[model samples]
Target: MGDRVYLNVLASRFRAQLSYRTSFVLDFVAQMLGQGGELVAILVLFGRTEELGGFAAHEVLIMYGIAGVAFGIADLVIGQLDDLPRLIRTGQLDVMLLRPLSPLAQIATGDIQLRRVGRVATGLAVLVTVLSTSDIAWSFPKLLLAFTAPLVGAVIFGSVWVVACSVCFWIVDGRELANTVTYGSNMFTSYPITVYPSWLRRLLAFVIPGAFVAYYPALALLDRPDPLGAPAFLGWCAPLAALAAAGVAGLVWRFAIRHYQGTGS
Candidate 1:
């Protein structure tokens, strides 16, 4: 697959989406409002107590910001892959298979949810708000981290999306389970991971590894020692975690393709 072809295809889709400006605006606003519900829940929780799970409101907001941007960008770029089951059921998978270009690249460009820019915008707002109000001293390294963390997070979350969608090859309606994992992790990561029960914590850290996506990276950013028993340097492991997630997702995706017997003509 030529990079230029992928870029052109993505660009064309983006232009097409722009043609429906009203629909685009409504979709964007709806997405933003959906994300707002999470912010409200956090506010209500903090209304009753000064802190939840040993994190101040601002600290939690920072973590939330990181999680938001990471999740948003990942979803923006690769979330279309989640539509695999639907395409397969509708026999559109055969069209993609007949294409000369990479089917994954085609999917990447085909169903770009421009509405997700709302989530990314909200996330940037959160990050800026927290940065202005929070007491954490900003250093050059810290600034670099703040900039790069979201990209690292995008890789991690996008990789998970890939693996989740890969399962569609085996299960016809795999979306619900995948959403449970992805959305559940998004909701769960908006606060300190330490707040969850031991089993849940272990699951996020070891199985899905959502904990490392935002929590550990935030810990490193804020210079906070682990409230949990783990060593401090683990905070710096987000990029490596992302790489691992991508590696696993790539293996799963390839395995799935090999097994994929496309829907009949």
Candidate 2:
């Protein structure tokens, strides 16, 4: 019953947004630029060499292409969904909490940036092109994992956003730190992780949960022998890692909220 009400609210808001054509065009162009930069980086790197970290130019192309699209899809659908912390700090959260619907549900469907759809379309085109040319041996399990990879990436990335927002409860201005983690992680994950130094790779593994986002699944899809020797089954850990990250974010959010209420920040 509650979900329906929130859905109605979101649907109404989405329609209202569509009524503004100028806002939509500007947003779409901006999303294109962001995704375009990512593609351009990969192209420039491949132009200098045939492969990086044992990944062929084509393979890395596929990786970035798919990763870009997957990331865009998540962003288009729920990208701005991470702004809850700013909303809370600005007292916008109070309005949300007072509603009959669950705050999370309300936030999830609160806004849809239709302009980002261009990124989504361009990304899908690249992913399909790479997959068609590549010699990846497709199977049911592999295909399932391919489809699931982007979703896992979104959840993992989104959790970082939530964790950042949660901190606003205590330090209303702590969002800068969150942006560092979220944006830094996004830029790093756009490439093959193996290309990085050992220390950096390890940092991503423990601190950011990025290894599971692209590296592990790419290993499975590409059928590349794991140079790190991670177990073959480790490739499937993306969803689990995403869930764990979200759980931790949930805890942090609760803690932050408590501090917010107590400190009145």
Candidate 3:
């Protein structure tokens, strides 16, 4: 029953996005351009220098593809609704909450954006290109892990989005900071984390676990050494780390809702 309701909501969103054909096409083009520019910048940087922090040009490209696909899919689906706070402020959340199904699920399925499909295709193209050029081994287990790596990355990025949105309940102005986390982290994660300073690397690794989400896992997939000597367990723990982050965000979201002091709309 719950799954059926979610499907209905998703169908409605798909139809609505289809209603704005021109806008959706333009949005898709803009996103592809922006993403393409990001990759071009990385390529130009690598052209000047063979490698950054022990990762070769193509290796770094793979990392970019990993982060891009992961984040693009996430934001296109569950993460883009970071606007929940504004909805709650204007009493918009009341309608969602009053629905028979879960409000959170409703919000998640409310917008089935097809523009993101273009980004996903571009991301996968880059991913396949890099993989084809790289010298990574292709054992069944390694192949399985490599394919699933993006899933963990997507969850991690989405969790960050959720946490950022939840902060809006306490401080409406904090949404900008949340954007910094979502967009900044997305950009930062696309490269080798080792390029960053020591303190920054440690912060992202332990504090936010962003380092593990892509960097560490990519290192493992590429059969490279752990520059920071991150624990062997860290690579396997990527999905768990994402789950932990989402769990914390969910707890905070619940608290915010319980104590929701509306903007009195």
Candidate 4:
């Protein structure tokens, strides 16, 4: 019942966006171009250097593809949480609290932007192109990891989105700060973490676990050892990282909601 309501609301919003066909097309193209520009930058860098952070061009593309797809899915789904400040400021959150459905669920499903599928498409194209052209050792486990990595990465990113946006309950204007975590994580994971210095790499890898989003998975798929000297098995730990992130996100969201007082607007 609750799931059905969420799905229905998402479907309605998706259809509403599609109603503006021209606007939707332009939005979709703009999203693709915006993300595609990053890919172009990666290619241009490779033109000048044989390797980036000791990674070949194709290897970095794998990271980009995974990060792009994962972030696109996260942005398409939970990205609306960025609007929490507006909801709080306008007292809309108070009305949400009176509803039977979970406020978080309502906020997540309130808007479904189908145009963001453009980013997913862009990533998928790159993933398919690279996988077909690159000389990866194909095996059952590698194939399974390839398919599952993006989904797991999406979960990790979504949890970060929730946890970061929950700060709105207190600050009510913390969207920019939250973007540093959410969008910044996406940019960080889209490249080999080796490109970053040791301190920043450690922060992304352990503190935020952004490396699990794409870097480790790409290494796993490539059957390469971690140059940072981490254990080989760390590549398979994205699911565990995602679970931990989700747990923290849930706790923080619940704590925030429990302590929330209306803005008195």
User: Judged by TM-score, which candidate is best?
Assistant: 4
Which lDDT value does model 4 have at 220? Answer: 89
lDDT of 3 at 202: 74
lDDT of each: 0.85, 0.74, 0.79, 0.91
Reference-based TM-score of each model: 0.96, 0.88, 0.92, 0.98
lDDT of 1 at 117: 86
Name model 2 segments beyond 4 Å from true: 262-265
**lDDT tens digits, residue span 41-155, model 3:** 9989988999888788988888888888888888787764677766766787877766787667777777567788776666778988888789988788668767877788888
Model 1 Cα shift for residue 163 (angstroms): 0.8
Candidate 3 CA-lDDT value: 0.79
Candidate 4 residues 205-256, lDDT tens each? 8888899999999998998999888888989999999999999999999999
Error of 2 at 171 (Å): 2.3
Better of 3 and 4 by TM-score: 4
Compared with the true structure, what per-residue lDDT tens digits does model 2 show for residues 83-193? 766677577777776677656666667776677777766666777788788898999998898788877877887777777666656666766776777667767777778
TM-score of model number 4: 0.98
Ranking under lDDT, best-scoring first? 4, 1, 3, 2
How many backbone clashes are present in model 4? Answer: 0
Colliding pairs, model 1:
none
